[model samples]
Target: MSNSNAERETWSTRIGFILAAVGSAVGLGNIWRFPFQVGQEGGAAFIVMYLAFVVLIGFPAMMVEFVVGRSTGLNAVGGIREFAGGAWKYLGGLFVFIGFVILSYYSVVGGWVLRYVFGSATGGYIGTAGPDEAPVAQQYFFDIASGLDALLFHALFMALVVLIVALGIKRGIELGVKIMVPAIIAIFAILAVYASTLSGAGEAYAYYLSPDLGYLIDNWKSIVPAAAGQGFFTLSLGMGVMITYASYLSEDENLGIDGGTIVAFNTGISILTGLIVFPILFSAGVSPGDPGAGAIFVSVAEALGDLQFGRAIGVLFFATVAIAALSSAVSLIEVVVSYAIDEFNVPRVRATAIIGTLIFALGIPVTIDPVMVDLYDIFAAKILLVLGGILLVTAVSWIYSDKALAELSKGIGSFSGIGTVWLWTVRVPVLVVLIISLYLGIDSFIDFLAGPFAEFLA
Candidate 1:
């Protein structure tokens, strides 16, 4: 309270801040992709990789982000300027710009989730998830995602985001996440418990959790990148989202503890999502299911359709997804709003309105053209985000260097012996991993465009 300013706000409580962080991390990925990956890779082995990734890459990078934001007390752009100075000032703008490009397409995808929510409530996809109707499920997604429907829903989703963020940090983002995060956790916990009671739940559990050291060794090549990427990404690092959020924190707040807490909650929700998913899937007799891009839409939707109370279950799952999507979307848009507030001296409302509208306008193309959506998603996930990760690593390594560590070391053990280890890890190994991942991702995306987009455009 000592450093209070009329122009800025801090989280009302540490708990509220943690909740918002968890909400940001727990997104559509947890519900669908994380669960399927757990099931596919053998739970124990995947969890091993997940924990390793968190410890090695996610934890250190997260603390550096917090240190930068809290020390400088600004959004990504200004924070970098404060910490490093010189040409580095403009470097923060890269993250801000990355956030903008990401949110534009991200909102469109969120709109698609909203459409699914309505469909779930109305049982529109009720029988469409049946084996013979797999094509119907695919068609259902396309039908809602294209043309006018897509545009309207995207607008609706962004409107909700604009409304919340316009309320500013304390009243809007913090309050909203406090409610949404706990509710998401509670609902998924309920689903997990319910799933555990299903007749074939044991089989799902064994498949999801049983240790498979041999499997881990056998598949380490493919598995390492997957776990590392998800671990880093699940924290929403490198987007300026964390930087913006942490900028609202009091310096006395424990960056190390907060980062750990966020990871713990994020991992818990991911596990909860898996427990809920695999059990219900086994009970519903949907097999050959591994968590991937369309896994949740296809398998989860199918399982819900097969259930006795499918209408209610359908509503619950999709509603959970909607909340998760909204939570992340709030962070994405807030990055831009924070940048505008800092850079241009704009009123929060005016900044949000203009930026929100502009981002929504950018999404119109994705709404109209699914091909473009796929392209943007690929570009964002594969290229922009990887580049963002590398940039942060470089910034903390050479740009911020000693200052970043000194900031992190303020009464925190994270800045000491082990912290030095963290520094080198991010500089060499982590940077190497990210760069290689970027190369592989771009290669895969090009192949995808060559194969699928080529046929579709033709």
Candidate 2:
């Protein structure tokens, strides 16, 4: 490659960089996972706790990742090693491994979204809409989520991710995010406006927006960890994805302001998603606590099917999700490719190809088995994120220390005062809460597994 091409590969305009990072941070975790988690954790209460965690914990943790990335201009492995010295490089390796593991399952769900988009266009699930939409959607979802059909779509999604990253930073990553982010927001906004007109919209809003203080008291043991994990997942934390994105940023950007903007945008989109989805589902008489991730698909599509513009709405909604999922998947692929290029000195195109191929291969199990899809989803969402957050906290608090803090304070003048508060008070307490929350979450999860719910899995 020419030097000009190589130089072009490293550069991204400020807006492009911000959009790209926000695009990665905002995806299925926000749209799909957030509403469901809120439904389970008592809606408004979960939202309140989640917002607190996002502002206090997620934001500071994001800044630390940003600091590491901008300070070293290296991928996760190189950044950790450079900032924390020799013994801490393994922490970087841990991040790379987690990122790879997450991509394997994440691509599976992205493929499902791809399948649904095409299915909606072809009128596959249109006739199957019902009051108890969960069961109907589950059957259709199960039929498509496994075996050769899923594998082909997963390969297709992975291929798209590879093609984008192969184009390098500016033309590929930044440009795609620039287009996709606005498209996602515009489409979701249109849906939210339409949902507002539904007959059961008022009841749906109450169900989703009203504070259920009693549920919070009953489930606080489970709710804390669920909220924290959801917060981390929505921000794409613990997988080194943000760290990779931050590596591309120039020092002139204020880490505090940029990180805050990303978090706010991500959180805002999630809130909009809830407004769009829950109102529609509840207005249509669908319960919010419906089991399985496919519940949303079933409920929303069924409601849309009954409307005058049902097919059109269904097509647009699924299409929005497909675009959002693809944007995030591309970011995940970029993280892996960035590491390959930075650590091994591999060409960007070659690294993208290699990592994409590996993810495609690893996604096979999830694609071929319905059970494995749910298993992988649960493992990644519930287990991997909590463990990854723990590692991130340990690395930031104990290993990097003042060096990380110093890098975080650079360029952003106001950040020095607020950043110090973040370091000593906010960061430490949040980490402690995450640890305790993880323990409670695991205990509750195990108890749930061993209880009557075990039969459902069997």
Which model scores highest in TM-score? 2
Q: For residue 32, what is the lDDT in candidate 1?
A: 46
lDDT of 1 by residue, 1-458 (tens): 11223477778999988888888888865664476566556676887888777777777778778888888888888887777788877768888777777778778777877888888888776654456555555567667877898889999999999999999888998999988998898888888888888876998888777768898999775566566556655788767878888888886676777889998888888878878887888887887245334555667666777788877877887788889988888888888888888877888999999999999988888876666766775666656667777877787886667877676666565446556776787788788877876776677578778986787789
lDDT of 2 at 410: 80
- Candidate 2 segments exceeding 4 Å error: 1-9, 128-136, 444-458
Q: Tell me the RMSD of model 2 versus the true structure.
A: 3.1
Quote the lDDT for 51 in model 1.
75
Off by over 4 Å in 1: 1-6, 36-48, 128-136, 211-224, 288-292, 369-372, 411-418
lDDT of each: 0.77, 0.77
> Which window of 10 residues has the lowest lDDT sum in candidate 1?
1-10
Clashing pairs in 2: 200-283
